[model samples]
Target chain A: MAKTKARVKVPKSIKKGEVFQVKTLISHKMETGQRKNKKTGKKISRMIINKLVCQYNGKEVFASDWHPAISANPYMAFYVKADASGSLDFTWTDDEGKSVKKSAKITVAG
Target chain B: MIHKTLETRQVGRRELMAMFGAGVVAAMGVGMTPRDAMADAKSVTDAMMKVVGDNKPATGKIKLDLPQIAENGNTVPIAVEVDSPMSDADHVKALHLWADKNPRPEVASFRFSPASGKAKVSTRVRLSKTQNIVAVAEMSDGKFYMAKSEIKVTIGGCGG
Candidate 1:
């Protein structure tokens, strides 16, 4: 099995109802189904990070559907409004049903 | 180091496609099949319909950033930005991207809420050949906006 790691960056605290940026990057090869192993001479099956979803305070703030066309080690950035103090969850799902999850805390300053 | 590895891999992919008699596809000129291009167009149309229903996406508001020419098809950098206030009253809800020539038309999508301060995303995608990259942004009021850019790819991004 291939190793995976997910990274997220968000502000420690934000004003209530303020929109802030969220950045995410994942480590994955994103092997497209077109390559072949040099030694075995067989096609390497395609395995890529297919989807990403981000939730803030249990509400879906951002989501993405990715294809093999996306480069390896995907990086995406978006903005979100900070409604209340809560955890921002990031989940990445791959082609094989494998998922990597990470979260960061966001505190809304009154 | 990354460029070196990608160069080698691109060469390998090109050679493999040649071995499989797909060299003609590389020379897309007059030899390219109309049916293939039609299929590609259909997929992109379906993807657009899925997002905006029957509504026609108006131009402007969305900007597509991509290289005018890409030496490598495996990794083409792209960015989509929508001009919006991103407030609770009016914000971008979702963004969808498509490649008009790849085996699969849908490239990537992004969903956003008002909490997100802006509507912009940057990523790298594979292009099968010289084709246009289309992006559609769905707004809070159920309106769709679109933008596209043409990019030339030397080698196919998806498996030829």
Candidate 2:
């Protein structure tokens, strides 16, 4: 309902060929659309963030498909290998095809 | 002869109890249905078939991390890891999660690539009640690994 926001955390420093961790969380209600309006007695249509894609240095690295079972304000963590000095982009899309994108920088030391 | 008769009667009674238990669960499922999302519910068998098809997942190489009992079912933490080298030729393709007793068996799916570098993921999920959380990992080599852990939900999350 409000403006959605996302946060990404990457290691401050990285070494070449080293595996690093990436953690992300987004603020969302994740309405399942299964609940009813107590006063109106009508069903609330499902609206949830359905997909997430993580790209490292412009290439797809990790992704996930979320169902209604995912908790509101989802948080996820995964690992990535440092290839070069670049940015990691994360795109979260909802059931309506509307999406939000966030990015973080990664510097791999030679 | 008297002891033998008692043993036979006990076995029959156990069978009857099992039949009644199954019937009760089926009735509960229907009673909770709201015509749409609830009715799309699935049993464990159908859920697995839809994902892995006819190939049964082998029970190893996968680890499921979850609390034995969740104080709050609204947000249950879950982590899954697979033991693999994570190479281009043999890495985990996707990891699937589902709960056995929820109104709907579908949970979430995680897709990975070689760049992922590790066969692990962590997230939070909502559990409708006490149930087994099943995780299945699909490898690039067409092999499937499976693991399951049960979580007792003290406060049932009925949003499902």
Candidate 3:
């Protein structure tokens, strides 16, 4: 069994209708199947974050599917328009059939 | 292969201040003197050539933004902006970022569509040492644009 970890961080409060930046980074080796194990002399099976999806208040804000070329410890940042106070959910899935999820809540002030 | 040209077009204080304006240049937080920055630029350029292949002339136009001196190398702020409207008729196809001297040369590559609205991206990256950062932007019309800058890393970043 493999252990996977993910963390999500966002401001506790935000102004409604104002645009704010969101940053995310997941801890993973992102092994590209191309590498070979020195001891076994066999190609190491790929273990990577195949997909990342972010939803704000049940509406999709951003999503991306990664490839072997992506570097280790992938970090992503983007802007989100805060329409109303809501929860932001982040989900990441790997090719190995494993998925990790985390979320953050933001309060929109008038 | 086009990275050589990028190495030559080093963004000096005068040039950088010209493109981004004095406000941006000031925000960069450069601690080193002009002489030191120039020396670091040369070394960083040499390091980039080692990883990007032989004699490839990287072009200009890709806009790269980084702090002149980073207090922490573990989380250095980075931004890449390209001059593309990102419309159906014309758009930025892809943007690639490379740290001249990180353990891994290629940091990240973003593929965009007309729906992206803008060809700009901001993120944080880890720098192992003082080095030059390079960004290459590819347009839908099959043209390449690039930008580079020297960043002084006070402390070694990358969990070493």
Q: Candidates' DockQ values?
A: 0.50, 0.35, 0.08
Which candidate's TM-score is highest? 2
Write model 2 residue lDDT over A70-110, tens digit each, in one string: 88999999899889999999999998899999999998888
**In model 1, what is the error at residue A18, expressed in angstroms?**
3.5
Give Cα distance to truth, residue B139, candidate 3, Å.
0.7
Q: Which candidate, 2 or 3, has the higher TM-score?
A: 2
Write the residue-wise lDDT of candidate 2 on B1-160 in tens digits.
6897799779866864664454445443422211111123346665555456556799999989899999888799888898888898999988888898775577888888888889788998888899999888888887888998899999876552
Report lDDT per candidate: 0.77, 0.80, 0.64
What TM-score against the true chain A does chain A of each candidate get? 0.91, 0.95, 0.91
Off by over 4 Å in 2: B1-41
Q: Give the candidate order by descending lDDT.
A: 2, 1, 3
Score residue B122 of candidate 2 by CA lDDT.
91
Model 1 residue B9 CA deviation (Å) reads: 26
Candidate 2 clashing pairs, residues 3+ apart or interchain: A33-A46
Candidate 1 regions exceeding 4 Å error are: A36-42, B1-42, B154-156
For model 1, how does the per-residue alpha-carbon lDDT over A1-110 read when each residue is reduced to its tens digit? 25787889988889987778888888998987767787876779888988888987788877887877788888887778778888999989988888898999988999
Tens digit of lDDT per residue, candidate 1, span B1-160? 6897799779876764553344234324332222222222235765565455556899999988888899888888888889999888999877878898886676887777776778888888888899989888878887889888899998876654
